[model samples]
Target chain A: MDISNLLKICIKALLNNKMRCFLTMLGIIIGVASVIAMLAIGNGSKQSIRAEIGSMGSNMIMISPGNGRFGGVRQSGSSMQTLKLSDYESIVRQASYIDKITPTVQSSGQAVKGAKNTPTSIYGVNEQYLDIRGYEIASGSCFTESDILHANKVCIVGQTVVNELFSDGTDPLGQTIRFGKIPMKIIGVLASKGYNSMGQDQDDLLIAPYTTVQKRVLAINYIQGITASALSEEYTDQAIDEITKILQTNHNIRIGQDNDFNVRSQQEMMETMSSVMDMLTVLLAAVAGISLIVGGIGIMNIMYVSVTERTREIGLRMSIGAKGRQILLQFLIESIIISVAGGLIGVVLGVAAAKIIALFGTPTAVSTFSIVLSFLVCVFTGVFFGWYPARKAAGLNPIDALRYE
Target chain B: MNEIIRLEQIKREFIVGEEVVRALRGVSFTITQGEFVTIMGTSGSGKSTLLNILGCLDVATSGEYYLDGVSVRQMSKNDRATLRNRKIGFIFQNYNLLPKTTSIENVELPLMYNRHVSHSERRERAIAALKEVGLGDRLTHRSNQLSGGQMQRVAIARALVNDPVIILADEATGNLDTRTSYEVLALFQRLHRDGRTILFVTHNPELASFSSRTITLRDGRITSDIRNDRIASAAEVLAAMPKEEEE
Candidate 1:
């Protein structure tokens, strides 16, 4: 018989035993739904961790000075500045994966604005520094490249510095402040970052053009460090590789020699944050897999009983001219219909359950991958578990089957 | 008359533990088209064995059997199943109507295995068969909702739906009361009058009077094969019964 007719026959048979079909399907429904719901919650936590890391600039790469052996002399860390303006310029010229790059130079001193003074560090940065460090300007604008080239004595003060310097509610924009001996013009106020996980206030710093800090405050032509960001989090490793290649080439380092700088991306910190989430994901998968197996076992058990119960029916069909293969198809299709229908209902229930969980604020995210994966798994489970019973139905002798009570 | 079935020295055996019980020793018979033949025997007379081989539900250990001019002796199991589907109809003692299934669907069961019968055609034939058996209005009724006589009519409709070459009835009326049995037997007699070949296997000796021919088996052997000059009308016998016991 044609497949459509066979399908109709199988469907009719299943409908004849609706209660049994439904009870058999319940196991699969629970399995698929639980798998989807658990995965949604697991994926949600993973996404949240990614977002938290993203907030700290996940792709941010910090190129800092490292130990280096120059021809005859070994200059370790602080004894020599390994990063240079030439190295930074070469990285900018050659790197393709980097989205943003900034040169940084640092100096700390007592900052004064009229009567108030605060011991704070002043950061030397350009226009790209805010984007690289995920910092925002509350008002006004950053110091331009023109300020860097001209060594303009312009700076942006953080919220804490603004509070310390102008406690009387006086706006600090366009006001002049002194860092050690250098007098700087405040052009912008940094947005408040509150305190970090380390309990350190992040808004107690000032930012100026790197050239201004290098030429006026420190009187140095070399850069202290370089900060950059990849085009996206996916390209962080490639971006680091590009930066390392350019820096090592500019430094004249041999193949076996250690580079004069270290490229540290926040990707490392993201890894440490993922361990607990990974454990939860694995636990969920294990529970879901075990339930699916149990559901498969339920299908197998029901199919065995169904074959036994329908023995006379099978014999009658065979007597009326049904091939053994046709009998097998009928039973197998019945099982597959049960499982696939259960899977469809489970998908709906799972998504609804995720939404319900989301309403409780656990942050469930149902992805298309989990749905497709669960669907394929259930179909496979049906076929795998339904095989033996269908074979048993197909292999029955018509004489015995017709005579079966 | 065209010969519809020809059997030559058919034999069947079963291995029960270490002992082999010979069910059919050597049985031979030929049935023509439009013949109503009753195979009569007591239990263990090999009547059921002969019926099974004739229905193609079981193969003989050593025999040459032909149905509708096709050799069934050496045919494969699948081929035999197809042959049975196209050439055989079966009516059982219990009616064997699929539970919770409508009468029309039960009638459609045989045609389901025939790929040439389309869905609409299948329905048309099932309705036609049910209507023929006086179950036209009960087409949608399930097995449990039907009376015993009505269920047998439905089974007869199922048997007639596929229009096979020969209809095989194994104690078709064994489970019914005398009135219902006569009602079913009358239906069979009408089918016989309509020129359909029939093989009725029954242990009841009185039931053999309704058929045109009777073959008696004893100890896996046919003891008598008689052609009855006068066939009894089951409908008349049913009508002559007491009217107060009809319900």
Candidate 2:
């Protein structure tokens, strides 16, 4: 028999039992819908995290002091004080991939401006710190290079600091805010960055020239850390490598010796986070795959019942001239039609579900790859599960089947 | 006349729980084209088994059973199926018309298995066959909507639509009233008169008079095979009977 006629016969048979066919398709529908929705949710979270990391800075590399050994006991990384202004200068002057570099020192203190007072961390950095950290000035100008040379007491205040130290109606630019008995003039207001992934407030900080904070507040000659930005995100690894080589030679560290400084790139963090997200997405898809198998079993069960119930019909068809393979093909086509149709409907339902999830403020990304993959899986499920029942039908003896009233 | 069927020492056996029950015991027969023959027997007499073998639904255990000069015993299962499709048509006792299907579509069933038949040709042949069986006006009526006699006529149309070499009917009117049975038998007589080969199997001895030849089976063997010179005309009997009120 031709494929068109076979399809017609299968369709007619299915339509004769409309309710049963629809119920049989329900399992597949739910399976595919959940698969798509789960993967979308997983992919959406991954995208959001990547965007968050991107906002921090894609090409930014940080050089911090490594752990120090005192009395044969290892101290924390921050307490080492191994990074210095000279090391930062050597990197700035020697590294070819470096775009912008800055030395940083940090201290926590209370900022008091007349009646308003708030506790916040004060960061000492040059103007390049804003470029490396992807920060923009909201209002007022940043301090100049001359400010660092003169050791001027000018700072940039974040939005949270502005809100805390100044009244709602008062202007904050050029306002002098005292930091633990040291008053500094506010040169600019940094752009408002809402929060990090960890729910920490990002805009509650202050920025000043490193020389001023090192000389006046902290009273230290060595810098705490250095931040640098590469020419582009692709050059981050090369920039880190060049900075490490320059630092190693400047510190006179020979080969095979542990360096006193650590270079970390945001790109590395992005790759690690991406891999974790990929794993989570695969895990979710695997869980959803279990439901698909259950759905396939449902198809198998129904097909077996249908073959048993239609034994006489099979006999009649065989008597008329239907070959065994023709009967097998007929049943197989029926199952495939059911699953593929269910898969298409499930795709629509899943996309709608994703949109509904997005409305609830969770990110959802629907990828074409997942849709196509699920469709292929549905086809395979139909073939794999429909095999046994169709074979049983085809192998039936016509004489016995006809007598199977 | 061309010999349409030749069965030589055909035997069939069944292994029924340690007992080898013989269904056919070396029965031999030959049927020619344009012959109307009847094989009559009671239950357990192997007439059903004979009809199954003749219809190509079952293979004989040991025999050279030739259908239209081709040895069916040597044919593959699929080849036998093709031969059945090309050469034989069957009318069952229950009519076996697919319920909830229209008369024309039921008639189109056999042709659907013929790959050489185009879609339009199938419909046209089905319509022509139905018209031949006096069901031209009820082409779209579902089997359930038709009377018993009408349903049997639809089955006859299905058997005729394939243009096979012979029609094998197993107790074709076993489910009908005497009046309806005579009506269907009259149609078969008409087809037989039109030079169609037909093999009719039935337990009713009264139906034997409607065929030109009658064979009797007893104990898995042919008890008698005789030609009838005084065959009764079903159309004449149906016409002479009293007419009943239509429902």
Candidate 3:
């Protein structure tokens, strides 16, 4: 039979039994709606994690001073101040994958500018630290290499610090900020970067030259961490390899002894975060799949009832001239009409649900791939559930069916 | 006239509980092309069984049934359906037109089963069939909207839509009033005049008198076969009938 004619018949048949059809389609509706909503939520969570890790920095490798350990056991601290300004100098000279390196020292204290005073963390580094960490200078120049060599206590304040300290929008240049009884001159301001993935206030900070922080502020640091950039994103692994080899040779730690510091790239961080989200996505999809199976079962039950109710009609059609496959096609088409219609309606409801969730301050994303996949699953459910009842109807003998009063 | 259908020693047995009950036993008959034949019998006299076999709705347990020179026993269920669709049209006593279906759509049902007819052509043929049944104005009326006689007419139109050579009607007038029955018989007469072969099954002898040939069945066997030289015309039978007086 032609599909168009079968479709018309199926539609008319469904229209005649509107209540029954709607009841039958409800299962598919719920299935599709849940699938769409769950997928959207899962994708939203994944994207959030990626964004959080990305905010840390792109291609910025961290070389923390520690021996890599498995489980909870620590074999060694491994480094005796092998990571210093001279070592940073050697990395920039010898490593082909080195982009920029920054030696950092940090201190936390109350910083005062004018009458406004707020307790916040302060970081001391050269100009390269900003580029390595993917931070942009919002308004003023960064602490230069010359300033670091001169041990000039000039500082760059973050936007949050500026808001807390200077509300008049007045240029804070040439102004002195007191931190730990030491007054520092402000030279520039950092741009606002509201929060990172972990909800950390990225804009609440103070930046100053590393030499001043080491000599005058923190006073006892052998460099906490060395932040380095790769020549390109593709060379991150190579950059890590070069940094590890140089650090090992300079520290004179041979194989079998753990290296002094660990080099970790942004891509590794992103992969770890994405793998966790992938697991979550799979779990959500599995739950959605269970609901879809329930939906298929619902379709099967409805179709069985329909076949039994229309036994006389089946007989009549058979006696007239319809083949078994014709009857099968008719019932199958009816089931498909119900399923596909439910799927479409469910998609609309699901997208609306996503929007509502988003409006409630939760992120949601409904991709076209998910929509198309849900629709196809609906159709597949129809066919899968429709087969049994259709076969039963087609296998009915016309003589017995007609005799069925 | 050449024989259009032949049944030789046909037997049909049904398993009722543990025992087998024979519905039709060694029934043999031959019907010529364009002949109007009626099978007359009481309830459970195998008349319906014979009709079912002839209409390809059931296969005989032991029989050699031929339609248009092809042995029906050799054909599969699907092939039988094709033959029924192409050559035999059936009219049931209950007027089994699906409820909520328009008269035109009911009439077009057979043509829809036949894939050779396009949608537009099926509609045209269904309309023409309704017109032939004098229901040109009521083509859009659903089965429930029509009276018993009108519904039966719609059923007849459906049976005739495919232009089959043979029409198998089972108790065609059993549910109608005498006057409506006469009207239906008159319609059958018009169809017969157009050279269509018909096999009607009924218990009413009055209905059998309209056909040129009548076969009487008793206890699953043919008891009598008689051919009438002159059958009463449907109009003559209606003319001799008493009229209902208006209040």
- Residues B1-247 of candidate 2 have per-residue lDDT tens digits of 8999999999999899999999999999999999999999999999999999999988999988999999998789999889888899889888777767899988999899999999999999999999999999999999889999999999999999999999999999999998999999999999999999999999999999999999999989999999998989998998888888743
lDDT of 1 at A371: 95
Candidate 1 per-residue lDDT, tens place, A209-288, comes to 99999999999888889999999989999999999888888889899987778888988767866787778987997798
Better of 1 and 2 by lDDT: 2
Clashing pairs in 1: none
- How would you encode candidate 3's per-residue C-alpha lDDT over A1-405 as one tens digit per residue? 577777877888899889989988888888899889888988888888787777767688887777645465654543334467767777878989878888877889998876889998888787888887767887768877799999898898888888888887877777888987789999888877788877789889988988888889877657767788888878999999988898888878899987768788888988887888889887997898789889889999999998998888888889889999999999998898889999999899988888889888777888888899999999999999999999999999987777667
lDDT of 1 by residue, B1-247 (tens): 8999999999899899999999899999999999999999999999998999999888899988999888898899999988888888899988888888999989999998999999999999999999988888998999999999899899989989889999999999999988889989999999999999999999999999999999999989889999987999999998899885455
Worst 10 residues of 3 chain A by lDDT: A74-83
DockQ of every candidate structure? 0.70, 0.68, 0.68
Model 2 over residues A1-405: C-alpha lDDT tens digits? 799999999898888788999988988988899899999999998898898889989999989988768789988988887888999888878889999989999999999999889999889999999988878999999999999999899999999989988867699987899998899999899989988755678899999999999998899999999999999999998998999999999888999988888999988888888899899999999998899899999999999999999998888888989899999998999899889988899889988998899999888999898899998999998899999999999999988887788
Judged by whole-model lDDT over C-alpha atoms, candidate 2 comes out at: 0.91
The number of the candidate with the highest DockQ is 1
TM-scores across all candidates? 0.80, 0.91, 0.91
Write the residue-wise lDDT of candidate 3 on B165-232 in tens digits: 79999999999999889989989988988898999999999887789899999999999999977877
Q: Tell me the spans in candidate 1 whose CA falls farther than 4 Å from its real position.
A: A51-59, A63-128, A143-186, A191-263, A270-283, A359-365, B245-247
Q: Name the better of 1 and 2 by TM-score.
A: 2
Interface RMSD of each: 0.8, 0.9, 1.0
